[model samples]
Target chain A: MHYWRDGILALPTTSHYLQLVILWSIPINFLTKSYEFMLSAKKIIKCLDDHWPVLETLVGRSTLGSFSFQDVQALIQRHSPGFSSEQVFREAQRLLHHEVLIPLAKSSQLELNRAVLEFIQFLTQEHQLGTVGDIQSRIEDLDRLRGKLKAAADTKDVSEMRRFIRLMDERVREVVKHFRKNESAIMHLVEKAKADDTKLSLAKRYSAVMEAFDEYIEPVLQMIDINAPFQHSMQALEHQLSELILNIEQTGFLQSEKEPLVQLRTRLLDMNQIGREALIRSTDVLMPLREELRKNTLISRNASALLAHLRKKGLEPTLEQLVPKFSSDHQKFSLGSANQITSYMAELVDFQDEAYQMPEQVDPGDNANIRVPDLAEVLKSARVQKANTDLSKWLAKSYPQLPVDELLFLYQELSRAPTLKLQHLEQYSTLEVNGYRLTLHPFVPTATSGT
Target chain B: MQIELEQLTQLAEIHKKLSTGYHVSEQDFALWQELDTNEEAYSALFTALGNQLKRDSRGYFHFDVDDATVNMGKISRLFALTTYALVEFFADQGQDPLRALFEVEISHEILASILQQQYHLFEQLEVFSATDLKREVMNRMLRYGFAKAQGEHFKLLSPVYRYLDALMAVDQLAEFPGESSTSSFTSNQEQADV
Candidate 1:
């Protein structure tokens, strides 16, 4: 049978000989169709293996929309770089023919087959968080199947009981599968959110985490709660399956049915055990992150709000009363200590005064020969100068014996002379007089005050 | 009240640190363990010394005071502004502000940017530049047991919740003006003014 399937699958599309043989043999119809399905499945597995890079890229980018055939062809060419346009086109057609990539509705755009996409995501550990309703409905289906199984068992309808057992087994496996997938998906979300290079904004980064908590973790937690309907229903289903198994064990008439009953019972119990463990592990991984995000949001919000207040009301007023205070006795810059105080007190206590020392009088004869300049004589010298004459320069040249202060004193008196008109210069003039370089606003006579 | 002399070996050191407004946290090994082990004894000892010893559940010990000195008040205000500015700055960059504030070792470059961006706010605290900020706020934070320096970088200690508490208090005050907000501190913390 395998060789016949391979021979037909390997035949070229235009081979009329095989078609004629298949048409002539009516009994081989079902066999041929099943072979074709197996062939198609094998082709898809091979296509996925050969072009996984392209499919992975498509899965990542096409989270929402379908990709055009040309886009797939381009991805093929990009994946191999050396492939010709014809080769890329052939690869794309093979992907579609094998049903590895399927058309979306009647549109020409193609998408990864839903089943294959999920399989690949499972392999990659990049699962979308399934809703609580998904698992809840499965569990509800299991409950309904248990009732049917019990009825079939009561009547000793072995075929009906077997059918319900198969259905219940599938449902139990599905619930366990959902639990594991959702748990892994949440783990993925946390890792992506915590990754340092995630360029998403904080809100965007944590949105998936928040959604997982609200949509998956929170509702699932309620469902699997110890006293919740989920737990009770699971327990009821376990009890029913076990009762059926017990009934089969007691009745030797249905000895052939005992194995399937035992298998289904074990599966139901395993599902419950695995589901609880998965939820616990997921919650453990996620609880701290949820708490950290909550605290982070609170801190950032309060900080920003307080900052705005501080900006508007000013810092001192906004925070003055709120700031935690401490004792002020440990002054960092205090200059006085007990030792200094004691020293001051000691100095005050040792009260004594030395006898007043009178200094010896200096000789008076050194100043007697150098006569002091009379202000009247300097005034007479100034009145004879040209208009706008610099009083400082003239004084320095005429009375080089006088000290700078004494010269300045004469200049002050001459400027105030009632008999001579003089003008003060706004601009300064420098003079080397009496060992001093003085930059002063020299008193130059006004143009009108010239003699 | 009774006293246990043998159990209070870190009394003098604890008194010195707490008296100076330095929070004794887990980082202060022997002293923190001393306080943790014999809290009642230490509390009575400090109470007899005329100090209100505060044990914040957030993990630290401090000497609670009704009012701060003028200088300490100024320093505390600077701390408040710097912390708020850091939060805003980290949030703007999409980093978790609380984690960044506590976990990350803030470099001088980050400090400089925060100071530059919040120039108007820091000016009120007399923090004119990054160096001034390090000296007036960050370094002073070290002395007050609010942060620890790691070479050239620094990370805030848990007692920084004092400012975080103050941050919330400012909001509460705005919402409800008549009631005083003492969310974190053990004492009233509201003594009107320095």
Candidate 2:
């Protein structure tokens, strides 16, 4: 075994170069000079192939280039059979610490290996790489080698294990160094991609905010009455002042209470200034197009004054009185009937027509001593009698030339008496004067007992 | 009279067919069979009964059995068949009766059948009422299809063509055979016993 080991060690370093030549050669017959070259290449290739573990360690460190612990273990398992994944993994770990594979720091190698495995897993799962047979085969070969390294370490083959560990240490260092360089570049690219993604998302958010403002806010602003801005501002100010007052009251600080009140007054003054500015702006905007409306405002002020007077007095003014004292053209108003003065009066008084109610007769006895004549009795007593009317008709027909007012005065004077009958007033139905008939209805006071 | 009875019996048969999976009573079947044999008598009786189904100014048929007018039961029976046949025919033409029923004034029974046939409307049936049916019909007439209920009123979804078409068809059927010659018809009569 020691002689075989020495022979294996003495094998030409050029053996790998010869193997490379054989690997590069095309198929050829044994009779050709090319066949002699091929034959020499084949012997070297066989020697290297037979002692692949030794060649792999030497070449991996000097020429084949370094590999990760995983890759070194994979190579080990590939060249030597009967190695478990657990053994390969353990040996690979020991090699990584010995610095035989590559010159990487142990921590850096471990981190890079973990990252690479994670990346491989992501690629396999996310990109659906399991369907590819080549990738699967490579993964299996690497896993098997990892197992063999683990097994060698477990069996206490200290020299073989140390050699294996040193080989992996060198490979791991190279792999980690290579990965570190590439990782920085990849990191820079990823950072740039993330920045671009952030910019896109920010732009989308800005557009969405503008769209929401346009769809929801712009229409709402348009629908609001122009006068409402001032009203809303005033209301908000009032609410703020009220809240401030409440807060001050709750704090029970006398100085603070005064402070809020002063602040409120200042705020009100500021609001007044703002209102003036707004008013100026509105006047500037409206004056060019609304001269008629401006004129109408003066008339509306007068009408408002009149309405206020009526409301203060608690009196319902008639439509005649309430009508604005303006020309018909100036009075081009559109107030509803429900708002009219007459309608207001009718509602206020609750008036009903007396014609619909039952009539009540007055008794003369009730007012006999008061000297107040009965209005109803006076209307009833002035009736013309048909029998006395014949003489008055004859006199009216016979005395067409007499002055009516004079004849009626004479008739009234003749009919005057201390005791005048209610029926005697009907006798002077017609009195003729200046060819005009005058019908005199004389008043007679009815007799009443002295109270 | 026999023809009127036969039509009523046929309606009853259709109702029975829908409700209890039966066709007609023994008496109704015998009357139908007898009426089926005499086409001239049946036609004459149908013409007379059709004349009585004519609407007055109020747009309602004045079916009075005492006034030699169409019996209310006969008119109702005829109306039921015509409505059912219409629903079936519209359905066959790829028009969903539930949609059409919602488009016109129709009773809950018809709507229930429509719901039974079309499961999509089963959930909506619980919310509908008799008043809703009347308003829905008028809305379809005035507007066309189903309208959103506004307090007591309903607005139509489409034009009033469906309502006009249904009314016209019913009116034409009421004025059947020789009754078409008459321009005016009596209305506002009491409904007869079912």
Candidate 3:
């Protein structure tokens, strides 16, 4: 446990580094010689700061295992161009001596120390996604340790119980740590996929995203499901731990044991929460990209393929009845449906010619009355009758047989006549003729009929 | 099944638009909202009227007819060809066909270029010039509510997805065997209401 504390004390910075040290400490007991040779945390931190560019390059190429010494020195010189060749060699050697870059057992190739690699990954937030199997195995290990802890508690082997409790704590921390790192890794993957301006097709660019979805998200989703094995195992572990705590409480034989069990319980609960939240965040970031890629692929693939088909088959036969149909106003072209025409004919059958209604012809009783008296004859009569007589009265007497309307028509005509010379009488004389009374200012004929 | 009178406020206008091959999308704000809110009721009502009223998930409504008249069929084929050509046209320009189809306006100048470039294809449809394309297809698209006029240009609406879906389906038909082309296309035709 003090060894674990020493791992925690190695880096006073981010909790992730602390977790990294704890992770490194798990195998520290057997590698004491390497641990003793390892540089102080401050010296390592300073070294990492000085050579961050080189370390970052390595992290970027972390997938490529074990670079040669020359490769490492060249990386150093590339990043620190001002460094002399001797300085680059010396720095590379210093990295090797500090155990920051561990050489392979027999091979000349050197890999970045596992712990340093993880630390750099944490600082850069560029994590490689770990499979769900990694967490599952650890959880299964926790279950196995849980059984061992129960056996130790029954046998009252306090030391074994303490050791199991420590291991369980380590396991829980690792699970939580993995959750955080995997989340950051997923975020990195998403950002990379989206901002990838390469000429790759939509499908190719989102290949990693699709892989992450299939490999990580789907499996983790099931693992963290409320009704799934992961939760059930966690519950069983929790129950076992809680029951042990209760036993310690009642029996009061192992008061020292109570605290570690309690801590383990709290950690287990925290691990579950962190796992769930990490899953949610990963899902949140990935879902939209996944959907966008799916839709884009579907549309573009279809469009391109359909265009090819149109080219090969020609437009008409290719599209044929495949074209989308609209609810067309096709009925407008037809004259009439049989039903409509039949209904119209039925209405016609009951129809009559709507009574021809010859306009009421009033019999023109006499055409002679309608005829106007000859204007010249009237004027001649006026001349013979002599001047100084009321012309209207004479004309009325001469056309006495004419209807009143006709008589008035002759009077108006004589008044306006250009052939006759007449005077306009100012005196009003009421003349009765044709059963109608006429009021008039009689005009007298002039003496001279000016030729 | 019981639709309240209030639920069908736009029923008359909607029916008139749909029956005449007009796709009512969200651009028709009031009517779209009315139908969206009371979709089930409206679907049931239209179904009772011997109409297959479909609401596309992309947010549009239209009536699905089994077969088109000769003239409308010719118009539809021309529309299909134009859309496929557009997809190829945009894709050739390194633009996403779907995004360009919806987001960018197809101006008369753009349409002229499209028509000129796809001359042989358009000739098959009796479309020789831009004006012919506009009169025969683009204007009809506007009239049918497949696109909305934006000044001298136009942008396709969600209903154009029907053609994209048709494009994909036809491609699949060509790619795979044993898939009933008629049933698949007609089902898409069912989806093609809008």
Write candidate 3's Cα lDDT for A120-212 as tens digits.
666655556777777888888998998998899899998998999999988887787777767766765654554333467766766677777
- What does the lDDT read for residue A311 in candidate 3? 38
Return the top candidate by lDDT: 3
CAPRI tier for the interface of model 1: incorrect
**What is the DockQ (computed on Cα atoms) for candidate 3?**
0.15
Q: Local error of candidate 1 at A11, Å?
A: 40
Residue A316 in model 2: lDDT: 23
lDDT ranking, high to low: 3, 1, 2
Q: How does the DockQ of candidate 2 come out? A: 0.00
lDDT by residue (B3-70, candidate 1, tens digit) is 97877888888888887889988888888999999999989887765567999999999987765668
Candidate 2 lDDT tens digits, B1-194: 34445544444433222121111222234533543455345445434422112222312211111111122222222222223333432333334543553464444454444333222121222213434434333333222111344455443332122222333332221211111111111100100100
Candidate 1, pairs of clashing residues:
none
Please state the error at residue A63 of candidate 1 in Å: 0.9
Task: Assess the local accuracy of residue A294 in candidate 2 as a C-alpha lDDT between 0 and 100.
Answer: 18
Give TM per candidate: 0.41, 0.13, 0.42
C-alpha DockQ of every model: 0.16, 0.00, 0.15
Residue A374, model 1: lDDT of 73
Candidate 2 ranges with C-alpha deviation above 4 Å: A1-402, A411-433, A436-451, B1-89, B92-108, B113-194
